[model samples]
Target: MLNDRYDNPLTTRSQSARDAYVEGVDSILSANGDGIGLLQGAVQADDSFALAHAALARALQISARGAEAVAAITKARALAAGISGRERGHINMLGHLIDGDGALAYAAALDHLAAFPRDALIAQPLTGVFGLIGFSGLSGREAEQLAFLAQLAPHYGEDWWFGTQFAFAQIEVGQADRALQTIECALERNPCSAHGAHVRAHIHYERGETEAGLAYLGEWRRDYQRRGVLYCHISWHVALWMLERGDAAAAWRIIDDCVRPGKVWGPPLNVLTDTASFLHRAELMGGAPQPERWREVSEFARQLFPKPGIAFADVHAALAHAMSGETDALAKLIAEPVGPAGEVVAALAQVFAAFARQDWTESIALLAPVMATHERIGGSRAQRDLLEFSLVAALLKAGRPDDARLTLISRRPKKVGARAVAGL
Candidate 1:
């Protein structure tokens, strides 16, 4: 029955409906809320459907109901038992979702590939898992997984679904130029591919090409609108770039657009938190404390934490407190070991503390390692670039122009908008 949903010559009507359902599923995955109501109706009509269950599980997961997602996936697995081919690949996707370890999931995906080699659906999740682990620079297993993906690309064709994964791996490995080329190639092959456009935007944004990055977002927005999909994170990326460029007003505009009331498939809190953080930072940069927004952002940050541990939320919380001049609050917040995100927040808090004390040397020393580590891990490139710019400002204040120049030169193509370049 599950196999009939994907491929069955005899059940023409069933096959047509299933094809439309799969398209709806992909649209929902890409952040289309309009399809969810339709999908809900389709699932109700076919209760024994594994594909419907999988799609519902994905939709629920994006909506932030993890427990409900687990239930849906359980039903999917049971119904998928007699399925084969592409339908089995969908089951493997549920496995990837259940397993938190990206490297392990990628390995398991490869084992599934032995039985279904030519399935593009299988390649999509495998690529995402590899990119997740690869971006963290976790050696050995991540490297092997990425290499396997790169090898798989040529066999599948240059325009394969894994192309963006290869580009992201290149970026993580510090080959930004190559990453740009790879994405450009992918876009050339399929101009309408949102995946290619998204990757290209990241490449440009990370390299400090703010105007180019924004243009890519425009392109992506057109493509997304045409397809009735949404890129929720793109607004945050644009806001961060504007903030880094010292355009507080422009940044706030992006934030406003992000949180404007709308029907959305995923949890709207992600963008809400981003808008709050950007507002808090912009207020601080403008030399006024936004007390109300500070509280709002902090509350959202708290809500965002205690889950998969969003690194940005922790750093934003610490920064919000620091901007409000709540030194004690900042100190207490950074004390928790929230993994990579906490480390970043702690480093920033130390800088803010030193700055408050008018101790320039201490501030420079505190920010050095934080900047280095974030640059390596592909942390928000916009944020890292701005931090490097701030480091130069701190160094100049400390009368250390030589060190500032060295730091400026090390970031290369990303040095364009950096305040450090002015010091050079």
Candidate 2:
């Protein structure tokens, strides 16, 4: 038996397998390339390595390779019988998450963390504002995320990766100064870390420090490898700040160069959401890109048309269909019932559809009641602001200038250059 970097026991009997698994985990925490090849390579070196199988499954799930994820995890579970309890916990946690059972995943992760506090893999699902618990209907999610990290802080003393994770959690829960301090420590430790850059971008986004965010990301992102997982997302953040500063051209350039048809960062769903959401808002700013661009996005989105599982993806899918004038497809999507969060998704779908048709009154009506619950869609506040932007745009277009003003003021601390993006 061997232990991972976190001192969690592994069932692997091969030293080569252990080395590959450790490298894969490190790559994952660094938000670098998929690391799937390394994880799979570990299992190839030792087919009975349950942890490697589980890790590969988790990576597959993240990339939206659902069939492969299921097969991999099934193999992991079959081989996990003789593993240590903590290693078994990894298989269980990945199982729950891949099945979309977020609550069960969070519980398994928490239980695993209690016994292996430094297991970054297990800690990951419990630490972020958008982690398993964050998506599990937990209240005070950001606070809860911070509290969980606080407990594990001692276990990860001076770990640069942990520092970046901690900083982002702080930023999410309104501890801007602390986030800055923590992120500075992380960057000092590893300036090329995509995790550090991602957190630093979020910190700047929170404080409305648009210029600083742009400068920081511009300098750092130039050296960022295209293979990094955060490549598209970090570029998305850059586009956001550029939009804030009324530089739509620069923002679109980021979208075209980094996030679109060229690269593979993570899941297609993530890229689709960022591209479609950005374009939806860009159009509102009177800077509509080429119609062919919307058609390209719409075509990609159409492949997952009727089975939009996640609310966040569903809304963006709606944006794609609506913008492409695929009214029939959009109608069908609205009619289909998703799960508990379906109402919010359906309402948002209608909101975008209405906005596309210039039916401002309909857009306002559909978006207003569901506005408060937008967080349930499972994205960062910056991402969820797309909904608010849509509503405000509707309010103004509908001749309700006063309501639009109120909505704008309500978004406290304000979004960098969002007013310019919305033409407010």
Candidate 3:
């Protein structure tokens, strides 16, 4: 009865199994290399290790390998009967999540966290922007995320994995100054911390440190393997900064190389959302609409996200559909939005369609009403900036430069310089 790195008791007695499981958990928590493979090794070392199968299931689910994830979780559930209480709870939580029962999964995660606050794997799904809580479609989720991390802070003192996540929570809650300090110290402790690097990049974006962000991420991206969980999204950040710096070719190159539909080796969720967000953001900055690229992403959305439950991905899928002239698909998304933020998703779907048609007034009319509740769509402020800039673009296109100016000043005064609309 050895323990995990977090001191959670393991049911398996194999040292090799325990070691690989720990490494795999570290990989997942840090957004680094080969967690699934490591967990597979752990399972191979001890097939009875219920947590290894559960970890593999969760990793596969996060990587968008749905069928494999289901298989793994099923195995984990079959083995859960003999494991510790903490292990059984962990397996069940991930099972609910992988099976698309998010409400149950979320409730189970909170309950598990209350009993085992140091179970970073259980808490991982509730931490980041795309986590259960972050994408819960609940308003004030950002504040909730911060509070969730804050309460667990004392349990994970000086742990780089927890620090990176906690600092990101701070950044999302508009505490960038403090997040900067936290992430900097975290990164200093683990220089190649992918989660830390991503959080640091967000702080840079928050403070409008365009050139510095581009340079730092440019260097950081070189060593970060493509297999890393955060690779595509992190590359999205680099491309975005390059686009903002007027290095359009470099930006497009990154999109083509690492962030596009056919090219990206990351999660399908990341592929759909990042490509659609970057392409439209690039278009607002006067970049020509690449119909072929739009078609690729729209097709990607069609095949992968046939029915969108995640509100953030749904809106981007709608954008890709609208931009690619997949009117039937776009119309379907607008008519049948899903999840807690379905109302906001529906409106934004129409907004994207209107914007695609150059119906600026319609876009604005549809978009403005959802502005107050857009947080329910679930993404970090940096990722959701696509919507903010879209409104600015719509206002400019509708011969409402003054309104656009006021909107920028009133809502995102600090990001005015980063708004991409030509007239603005």
Candidate 4:
């Protein structure tokens, strides 16, 4: 029996196969290196490596290679019969996710971890805000995510991958000071870590350190390959900071090059949501989001997400549809929303629609109450700023400057530097 880097027993007897599996897992976890490529190499070196096949499927699914991922997972299930219990459970959980069974996947992850805590691959899906637990649409999700990572912390001290995730969990729960230090530790251990750089970017954004966030992330990402899992998202942070600093030109350039639809390599969820969010935020700042840009994003959303299940992406899709005058698409989401957070997503859709209609009063009324529970929409607080800024813009537009100022003061005290809203 060979052991992985995490000291978990592997059924693969080949050292080379084991080595590739270890590197592949590290790559996907950090969003650096060639995770899928290396996982394929692992399967090639040992065709009977059930864990490697399962892991390959996970990486493929993350990259949004749906058909290939299905094929890989099918192979993994076929090979699962003779493997260890840990291997069987690992495949099962990932199978659940690939089958679009988030609830089952989440439950299976917990069950798997109770026995094999060091199964970092099995645990990866449970770590981040975009993970199963974060998008579970449950209330107190931020606190829930932090507590889940906290429980797994002792098992993974000083591990760079786990450190970045733990640090982000803390950041989302309003623990900026503590998160800064943890992310620093992770970055120190793995300077090329894409996830490490991303978590640090979120910390800077949370604390209203726009200049520092831009300077640090801008330089760090210069060397990151564009195809890396987090490249478009990290670039979104840079564009956000540029907009904050009143450099709308630079921000739009970043959007055109990296964050826009068909412009960069990224998950469709990220491509659509980031494009819609950035364009709307730019619009709030009084920058013109061209008609063509809105149409492209709306069409992209329609093609990729004709129906909605993921609330985070759904709300953004609704924004694109509303802005592009895709009334039929918008009406469908409003009429029949489905998911735990479907209603929240529907309300957000209505908010965007009203904003598009320039009916500020209606938008404000619809948006205000949802702010209390917008965490159900999923995504980090920084990512959710689209809603916060949307509310501010609505207040400002509705001839309510005082209310807008009060909203900023009560909700985002530290982030009150930039003036993106009209008449504020």
* TM-score leader: 4
Q: Write the per-residue lDDT of candidate 2 for residues 1-424, one digit (tens) a residue.
A: 6888777778878999999998888777776754789998899999999889888887777666899999999999998778877778778888898887877887888888788788788777665545664554434566777888888899988788899989988887779999999999988987777888888888887788888889999888888777677788888888877877788888988898888754555457668888887787777677755678778888877775457656667778888888888888688668984854677677777887887788988888888888765766667767777887777778887888878878867764456245633546
Ranking by lDDT: 4, 3, 2, 1
Model 4: per-residue Cα lDDT at residue 198: 94
Q: How accurate locally, in lDDT, is each candidate?
A: 0.56, 0.78, 0.89, 0.90
The lDDT of model 3 is 0.89
Query: What TM-scores do the predictions have?
Result: 0.74, 0.89, 0.97, 0.98
What lDDT tens digits, residue by residue, belong to model 4 across residues 187-217? 8999999999999999998888989999999
Tell me the number of clashing residue pairs for each predicted model.
0, 1, 0, 0
Clashing pairs for model 4 are: none
Off by over 4 Å in 1: 1-13, 28-45, 85-96, 99-107, 113-131, 134-148, 172-177, 188-193, 206-208, 219-230, 240-248, 259-292, 325-333, 338-359, 375-380, 418-424
Runs in model 4 lying further than 4 Å from the true structure:
none
lDDT of 1 by residue, 1-424 (tens): 3232224221113544465566656444334434555556556666666666776776665566678777877887887666555565656665576544555656666776665554444455545321344334432433554576676765556652456667765665557898888877767766655556666777876676877777667556644642233355566666666665667677666565554224232244444445544554353344355666665555555555534234444555565555556666677756764543455666776776675565779988898777655532323354344466666656866888777667667765465453323334
CA RMSD (A), model 1: 4.9
Residue 196 CA displacement from its true place in model 4, Å? 0.8
- Return the number of clashes found in candidate 1: 0
Indicate the worst ten consecutive residues by lDDT in candidate 4. 414-423
